[model samples]
Target chain A: MQDKPFMSSLTTDEVATSLRRKGRWGLGEVLFWLAAAATLFFLPERHLILNEIAIIGLFAVSLDLILGYAGIVSLGHAAFFGVGAYVAGIFAKEMTGDPLTGLAVAGVAAALLGFATSFLVLRGADLTRLMVTLGVALVAGEIANQASWLTGGADGLQGIMMGPLLGMFEFDIFGTTAYAYSLVVLFVLFVVARRIVHSPFGLSLRSIRDNSLRARAVGIPVNRRLVAIYTISAAYAGIAGGLLAQTTQFVSLDVLAFHRSADVLLVLVIGGVGYLYGGLIGAVIFKVLQDILSSMTPQYWQFWIGLILVVLVLAGRERLTERARFLAGRLFGRSAGAPRTAPAREGRP
Target chain B: MTPALETIGLQKRFGGLTATDNVSFRLEKGARHALIGPNGAGKTTFINLLTGVIPPTSGRILLEGADITRLCPELRVQRGLARTFQINQLFPAMTPLETLGLAVSERKGSGRDWWRVFGSDREIVDEVVGIAQRFRLADVLDERTSNLPYGKQRLLEIAVAFACEPRVLLLDEPAAGVPEAERHELLATVAALPRDVSVLLIEHDMDLVFSFAERISVLVNGGLFTEGTVDEIAADPRVRAVYLGESVDE
Candidate 1:
């Protein structure tokens, strides 16, 4: 055997530079955010729906942090969302009505809940996680329902008056202010979430999601990472909920409903998962489709949405996304490169 | 001096079957040891017990004289006990760069940092690059682990464990299913591990066992059958009788 030490031709600096470059923002990302900003001036009449889209998109992004990146399947994500809405609502009504303050208060409240409940998820498989998460949302909804004095119960928390943004821009009925506020909040939080997923902490979560046993073997405290991410995701969801309550100036029990969780999950299914853009793109597609379809057939819009989901699943989300990327690359004069799919998991020997 | 890893009267019973039967074993510091056994001889189970993958039915395990029988698997790894799976257990979606980065970052106590970019930490990146070069995985560092060849994946499996900088390494069939052309590289890397890290190789390949292990322990029916130096085991008739089913001369 050769006794000479093995040497790699690549320098550490070169590799580090390349990795750093990968995390840099591309033109597409810049254009995507610019287009979102442009909606304020270009589509004045659509501000209300656009505001809703921004809030939902933020919620979806929060879910992606745990579901897409960490491989945590949470059906009770709305638990945090509802907590944020109620906390913001009560904060505005009882404490302070400052929108940013309400958001912070709601985020912290949801984070505490997330930290408390994250332990339940550490013990189970996917199915168990789903059940536990679902139970958490259901239980949260019930608490909100039973505490009529605090939450206004089934009637929902009303008469919440949010102060102007930064004590300057008053919230207008046309939703121009709300859209701008929601958009800015979404962008800031998305930037933070973007940083998180590309961090070492984020990489460990992906490892746990892919194969937790090997993750543990590599000396990663799997449960702790899960707890931390779950808590962060909850805070994100809470912030999204706070946006919804602040924008509309109302809090509803529907925020904690099961359909909210199911809907956000469906949004991820539409956009793709793992990558951060999936949530944002999926939100736009989902909300727009709902708007267009519901206008055509209000009652059967759900049926059409369900059909689309079935089609997306049957045709394979990855293949469809690859095709879309290929088309986009051709249109934009860039090489899409070879389409890649994750290799099928190998069974144990 | 204390043994690197020790198991005292370790036993595991699965219903009516005793998989690991009262096996008390010790691997001295910096020992190059191999555990050999027949099919279903409880080789993997013993490693699992030592790594704390599964709790023992009774008895204790120690790492460098520290009682670690009740330690969780990740905790054992934190305490400097690292292991590879019998099957290739790896994150299929992550590239080798990301995989090694995770290990190195975790070891350096920076795995929980969410604010900084992953490769922004120059120290961790340098170590990851060094380890990747040492394992000959620098070329495929950007390739997804599942996309790499079986041989390279196997190397990565060991590379990740090595990244932990463990005091004692347990390699479970590291060469299993590797092709003839790739087997030599795998075994060479295993043989070339740092001397300060005590290694316990669990393998069915006798050639690898003989070439790499200075000391050999034979396991039969979940119990320690015999243990001796390479020459002693090579000349033992009872070991042959158990392995080859040959009649023993009285």
Candidate 2:
């Protein structure tokens, strides 16, 4: 206890030491990110594969917010993603052609819905929460199908023309804008999410996830925070969906399918939840694998995915999780030279 | 000042079983009171009711002269009511300093910042340090609450709760798992509480109870069995025969 005066008295080293105690992502993250950025730039665009990867990456990262940081497990997050895409699509058809407005409208709409139904998530266990979310997405998807006038129903919306970026920056033929647009979108959201995870609100979510009862007893208002985070995460998903509709002028009913959401979950899990950047990396890795497996043997793609899933589960989620976290840290490690989170507990920093 | 809290006919039932059968008591501001009884005395249930966990079947809970029986837990907390568990309630992965910062933030209404680094809140940092120091948790501020010794965990739990600066605190068996050597520290902390802050402690350790409490209440089964000073309780023949589980003549 005596060390506190000296510890608290010296503000500089405390925060620095605190950050150091949190451990630095260091050189690994920089190299991985730079290399990743270089690869994306150098690699020739082929069949919109790179574009698809960006969309899925963003989707997976959105799921990571709820799954990893908030300890929420959802298999139906794609519902929000799909909803955003549809909103964006409809906006492009009727409203001004600027994609960002559509993105904003879609995000706000999805976030509002996420906030409304979040209470359903706050009370239930992980599995129960997943079911409720999945059901919500399923119902929303059905409604979209039934509302043929607005959503284009089962036929899906076609000829979505996002006039341009801000009605000026025309999308290039090489998809350089699409890739850069998606990349920039992903980068900004990731940073915001990072700030969130490191913020007090973010700490509360982790607290709720780790021990809801304790958090409540300490007056954290657990349920409210849960709902808020869910809403915010859904907003992220909405933005990701918007990015998709923007890059591709058409959006199909398949975007709203349950499989899309399930795939997003797989990305986070494969990457590792809770560890920031795990979902992003997981998205890239999962997309690549999906691409490779589908190309090698299109018919048996599921079989390869299933086999890999088994290995991932057997080798242990913890192992892959650590690897994911390590990779994520390397790619997005920014904790270096930053102030610490909180003073250590017992011996934990 | 008025009593920190008061409960009237706090009747609570789970199905056919009455968990708290017509219990009522008043905790004056600054009073160090102890509720002592044998096991299954409904002590925890009473705390739960006060904390808005389970609604009392037919009762009213008032805090600082305000009717708070219908208030939710968080709302009640906002109105300056706080409590701790019989078992240690802690965010295991977090350090004590982090834990207290959160507790202080919850009190200060800054717990909503989802992007602000908690350590960046200088006031909260100072307050956390202050609370942790008072509870003797400053030494282990960086350690995980779960990894600390059982006694230290209890101390940290109390410290964290204190970060809220609640007007009243309900401690459920603070000395339950703590070692004999460190029980005094726990008792001393409870004894040293501010005179204006009320504390209602539940414990089975009669010696510790007798020392820390200026007033005492005995709970038998699910009802208030008796209420009196420590001397009155120690002198009561029925208390010895019933709750002490010993011959009154002894």
Candidate 3:
């Protein structure tokens, strides 16, 4: 018991974080998080926008775990999200309508699916992983299309009667229950992920990304760690999907579409990599830009989104967070020391 | 007594070339053995065979007298056998302390958990710090490993390996890319490791080879050409001609 680190837990890193709060999640990140959270509360009758941002943020953050932390660049991440959504819908329809249970089912089901396909991902490069994962999602969409009685197919499963959450909090027609419910889930997962990222295991994943052969020689088992993280990321993605389904009380083939995965990636890149708050910032930017652009001209809305994405790419998405950190240091009057997280995959090796 | 690490009839072939041919070697419980050879010699291939990186064509590897020819690299590490590489394998994105922490965790046999930040045992953390400090990596504990000086990277790699607390440490050219000035410090660190921890150093630097090793094994072509004490190998006329430079091949 004394030898086991997880068991004998007199935490020093917590103390480190407290004593030196000048690390990577510096003042700038703190402000960005506050501003993002404040948007939900302050927005005037923009609940729909808020809801979309929250869901997409969770999805993107989940993707970022594998992408940024683990170096698994998956292009078909939407499959897990779609699977979660379908699982939630199925659970609500057949079993208990408990949002918690539905979310769990969605996550578990997606995790299982992810686990099964993880082997395919293990062998290939990012391009292969992308094509295979997206292929799975495309196939799944087709399956849902065929299983109209089960999944409601292309038209989507409808006539869902979602009972009160926890049998106490009733859902409103304004989508207040769904929005509030999803937001809480997102917050808890975010905090949990934050803790994970800062942990020793997380540090190893960064190492694996740095140089895998070197990691192996140092006695770090590269493949096993990658698989374990892949499964966990899948579970997170699955839960994200479930949350969407449970909130909307609907599941559709579109949930499994390639666009969803691509969009989640866009959100992650836009917000920032490595920083957990990046998801929220990226999601808000995407959703708001989407809204403002679409309203300007209902036709060719995607054209505007594509143009913004191009601009973001040209501006260097990573620079946004860097500039913010510089600004935060200036404004907060705290000397932000060097970033705690070393850049992932940075050295030309 | 069975050797701490022994390879019997170990053979490795790459396509038409036999890189390692029936190489047999033994390291006692505390043997500071040096495996040395000239360029094109199968010294690295032999190390790989012993470590199970490349499966032998027909041979058996016994760790602490137990057969481990079929075991994978991680499994061997778990069996108290660890190695450093010919090339420094430090994680570029990680500082020495963090890299040490990961090595410590792997040795503890814990699968990675993402949510497990800030609760590692104090003893383990202390041990990690001790290893880093000893390697002179305390200053670069938070700096990215790539940013460290070239010599420091070598030290950091050794520190990461040290965290494993292995019974048999296979160091593949520990001083390969090190500056002459820092080579002594590197040698001193290797010399100071626990007596019970046996070392197999594959070094081309004879100064380091002679300084740290008690007994030396020489590899030539693709086989064990000679095995003897430093004085004997240096004195052997045959070894001098083919390897020890005591005699000219001409």
Candidate 4:
């Protein structure tokens, strides 16, 4: 062991360096958000595709809260998504034409559903959670299919008539307004989720995920935290669904489909599950790939997508990124910028 | 006036076998006690029953005179009862700094505050740094728990339990896998614990038990065979015949 006096004196400075903000917004995070905003200015014509990416990004983020942070494997997250879409659709047609009010209604409805059904997740392991979650989405899809009088069944909800966002911006033909709207919603919610995952509550979730038994032994209320995160994630997914419905002025039974749940899970995994930006990056990649491949092949795009996913999985996220950086550095004759997220190496900034 | 922890006729059975057969135990405030027995003598089971990890078949566990027989593990933790595992149960992915920060924050009742930024809690941060220093973990604070040496991991484990600031701490084999060279450091840290927090250590190491425990309880076949001071336990021929002799043979 080293000298006790030197080690004792070194404690405060060393601890501060190590324990300080593990996830504060960096320059890269700021630049990324700014670039996302800049897209509205430059890519006005591609707003429709951008809007889709934004919605999926939000959905992936919602899944990340439970799957990545809290270590809950859910396969029926679309239950809340579908519920939100239907709730928003019904609110617009029957109760209110105001978009914000409808979105709020959708969010609350989905959150209530999440809270009510969260207990099932509390008692089970990964596979059991997956089954229960899948069961919920299945039942929800069945209800939507059978209730023709209320939901329009197979044809989907029609004549949504979403009043202008905040009584100002109309749902336009070019999708500029829709694009901006979803972007803003995604940005705000991302900020909130980002803050949450960096907070003390977020630390507890990580601890619970890493070791539930030890978490409880250390005075953390594991089940309560799980239920809370699950309900919050449901609300987030609900909001994403509401954004989709309002932007498109439509709600299809497909929103509640099992594929929606599985697709979102795939997007999250592609991006990097635990990190917030993983979902965002994953969504953009997934949507852009789907667009290009679907257009080129029109029919066999699934094969291309599956191939890409397999390659990505086989290579692994960190290794692939490192390889990409290494190749870029070698080609450009410039060293890669300090391997992002190596804060300890960089020392106090 | 009340014992820090007391178990009344605690019993546990797994259908055909009674693992802990109506074993009653007690520890006074600030007591340094040890529970020693042969392998599979149900020492872990007894600790589990006491900590509410598993409910006893029938018994009452009183903590500072309040009955906590049916209270959950977390509730027991809140009531100032904490324990370290025989095998360290730490979050493998997290650094010691993160782990200790969490333990400190949770102990101060801020574990559930999702809105508050973790690093901004200066008081909790300071407390965690203090704990890290106390356990000599400041050097490896940034290292992952799983990547740490066995001795450091054991120290971190005890530090985690200590972060809870429990009234009574149950250390289950704190020095089990630590190398001989590091055993002195572990023992010194254990010996330097605050006087207010009563300790009940479960160990197979007689050197540790004999030196540290003021009162020793020798358990045989899930029952308390004897309880006495260090010298008395060493001299007791019945305890020696059943446990100490067998321990030497093994």
Arranged by DockQ, best first: 1, 4, 3, 2
- Candidate 3 scores an fnat of 0.48
Return the candidate ranking by lDDT, descending. Answer: 1, 4, 2, 3
lDDT of every predicted structure (CA atoms): 0.88, 0.77, 0.76, 0.87
Instruction: List the per-model TM-score of the A chain.
Output: 0.94, 0.86, 0.86, 0.91
Instruction: Give DockQ: model 4.
Output: 0.54
> How well is each residue in B98-147 modelled by candidate 1, as lDDT tens digits?
89999999999988899898899999888889888878898888887889
Cα RMSD over interface residues, candidate 4: 4.6
Give the residue spans of candidate 3 off by over 4 A. A1-41, A298-301, A311-315, A335-342, A347-349, B110-115, B246-250
Query: Candidate 2 at B202: error in angstroms?
Result: 0.4
Listed for each candidate, the true contacts retained, as a fraction, are 0.79, 0.49, 0.48, 0.63
> Model 1 off-target regions past 4 Å?
A1-4, A7-9, A335-349, B244-250
Worst 10 residues of 2 chain A by lDDT: A340-349
Model-by-model DockQ, in order: 0.61, 0.44, 0.48, 0.54
C-alpha lDDT (0 to 100) for residue B197 of candidate 4: 94
Off by over 4 Å in 4: A1-6, A9-14, A325-349
* Top-scoring candidate (DockQ): 1
- State the weakest 10-residue window (summed lDDT) of model 3 chain A: A1-10
Off by over 4 Å in 2: A1-40, A320-349, B246-250
